[model samples]
Target: MIRASNVVYSYLKYGRTGEEPVSVRALDHVDLEIERGSFISIIGHNGSGKSTLAKHFNGLLFPKEGTVWIDDLPTDGKGNLAQIRQKVCMVFQNPDNQIIGATVEEDIAFGLENMQVPTEQMQERIDRSLEAVGLTEKRNENPGCLSGGQKQKTAIAGAVAVSPQCLVLDEATAMLDPRARREVIRVARKLNEEEGITVILITHFMDEIIHSHRIFVMDHGVVVQSGTPKEIFADPGLLEQYHLELPPVTKLAFGLRQKGLPLELPVLEPEELLKQLLRIRKGGGAC
Candidate 1:
């Protein structure tokens, strides 16, 4: 499990030498616990502390005032920092920025190489990682040559090669087109569902968050709300307060609900909205 207790983080404002540095709190006494085999999505606008919290998951940043622990290991300590990172892998936004290897297979092997996996087991690890991300055919291709979604998949493969217990994705699909976005989401879900990797997806996209096991809404350096997608979407005012809109189909359902049609709210899927409409029509306006 990932545990953070009253964690606080701050960064100094950069300016000319003459200017005194002022501390700006990015995460304000945040307390969070992410369980094993769970898929959690954190949603917030720019600078809401979501990215900062992601960094602490793998010990990239230590809390200024509180504590962050990955499993039984404390992130504030130095003894197990490398092991903590292996247990909590992070995939950042923009596949272009994450790229390192000359080829897809090489990228997957890079971490394993650094960790010094035996040469005899290298090909097996690379092949399995590529297969998991459905990039086996492109193993020989350069990572920069792939589409945005494929490139992100390559990044994911690299993380999985280490078999981390938790995967933190900080807007991994933000750079992809709609089609590519869906593809990346599918792969993320597969990792969570099939491999039981605790997946933490941080994004502002409402559509991608609906299917998560739980959703956390952050604003102004605090987690304003958190619950299942159904519960989170049940309150339109809460979403509005955070400058978030429901998925387009869900928003349409809410509008219809307000217009004398009793459509169920927080409709997670378009088919669900369609089914509600069909049932209402079949029942002659019955709720």
Candidate 2:
């Protein structure tokens, strides 16, 4: 759904004194592709350029050196901006920054209103999006009154209300609690699996990416690793080299396997590890 080639983006840091402005590269020669209707993740530590790359998916920031294509339309063109944005929508880390309307329903309507959708169709969209995010009952409630997770859902509902083909979540769950994080992730998964929307999750939370179809590991403004979740998580040493780590469950599984226990490799979920242990106890597999 999205493709970037040799993309480079830089931020100009101006000195308060009289020094010359310095250009710091946020994305350097990054290249990758995301398939339609698939869930993928971009992960990295702070200052690793994951957020900068997310912005390129929807043209929030144009690349300084290369091109970004959203569903075959290049992001560099002014005329294609509108169509490109419609094809790809984004939810950022802070829901407060994204939330502008007083009520939940009104917030979802904000994008449709900008698109000049007919009033009748707009109401239908509002209803559908509210239901999609499981917030229909809270439609009349103020977004500020909702929990962190609910606020993020509100943001996702607003994005969905626009009828986007692809959704880019740039650390959308960073500020939420664990339960709220799970809720937001579940909504993103449902949107991808049920609605056939391409979902690209940008996060540092390793556990959140375990279920993703593919993962792109970024560092120093470039994609250093890309593979299926299982493939990427299989080697903890490699991830550590990139300043990343396996999910807590995966690390536990790896630790057990290292201690001469019979267990499956790359056990991503808690239940999967439990199942393996039960099988071993039952003599289904050797220790």
Candidate 3:
């Protein structure tokens, strides 16, 4: 499990003379707990401290005031840094930045080699992770030769090959097209459900978060609210206050309901909205 208590981080500012040199609080008394083998999502607009919080989970930045623990191991860089990193892996928004090997298969095995795994075991891990990410056919291709989605899959395969207990995706799908974004989300879901890996998905895409067990909404530097998608979507007023917007399908359904249609007020999924529209049409609520 990952636990954070009263976590605080500040960034120093530098300017011309007599500026007072203020500090910006990127995370203000942030507190959260994530269980092992659970799937979760964190949503916020740009500059909402989503990335700052994600950095803490992996020990990239230590809290200035509080403690962050990964299953009782503190992220204070005393002696648990390497061990914590081994247990928790991070994938970034850009796939190219994470690539380390000349070939796809070699890239997957890079971490295993760094961990000094035996040659035979490394091959097994590479094969398994490639298949897991649906990149087995691209095993021998050049890393730069694949599409954007494929490159991201290759990056994920590399992380999976290491077999970390948890994977924190920091906007892993932001750079992909619609189809590629869906593809990445499907892989993340498969890893969470089939492999039972703890998945921490940080994204701005509301549709991508519908299947998460819980959603944490962050604004400015604090977590304003957290709940399941249903609970969060039900309060459109609260979301709008944070400069956040719902998925397009939810907006459409809510608009129709306001116009005297029988659509659900917070229809989160397109399928749910479709069902309500069908019911309204059959009941002669629409002209």
Highest lDDT model number? 2
Q: How many clashes does the backbone of model 1 have? A: 0
47-117: candidate 3 lDDT, tens digit per residue: 88998998998799999999999998999978898888888899999998999788999888888888888
Output the better candidate (1/2) by lDDT: 2
RMSD of 1: 1.3
- The TM-scores, one per candidate, come to 0.97, 0.97, 0.95
Error of 2 at 279 (Å): 0.8
How many clashes show up in model 3?
0
Displacement of residue 249 (Cα, Å) in model 3 is: 0.8
RMSD of each: 1.3, 1.2, 1.7
Per-residue lDDT for 103 in model 2?
Answer: 97
Off by over 4 Å in 2: 284-287
Estimate, for each residue in 1-287, the C-alpha lDDT of model 1 and write its tens digit. Answer: 99999999999997888999999999998998888999999998899999999999998899998899888899986788889989999998989988899999888889999888898898998888788888999999999999999999999999999989999999998998999899888888998999899999998788998889999889888988989999999988888998888877778888888888988677889889889889999998955
Q: Which 10 consecutive residues of model 3 have the lowest summed lDDT? A: 257-266
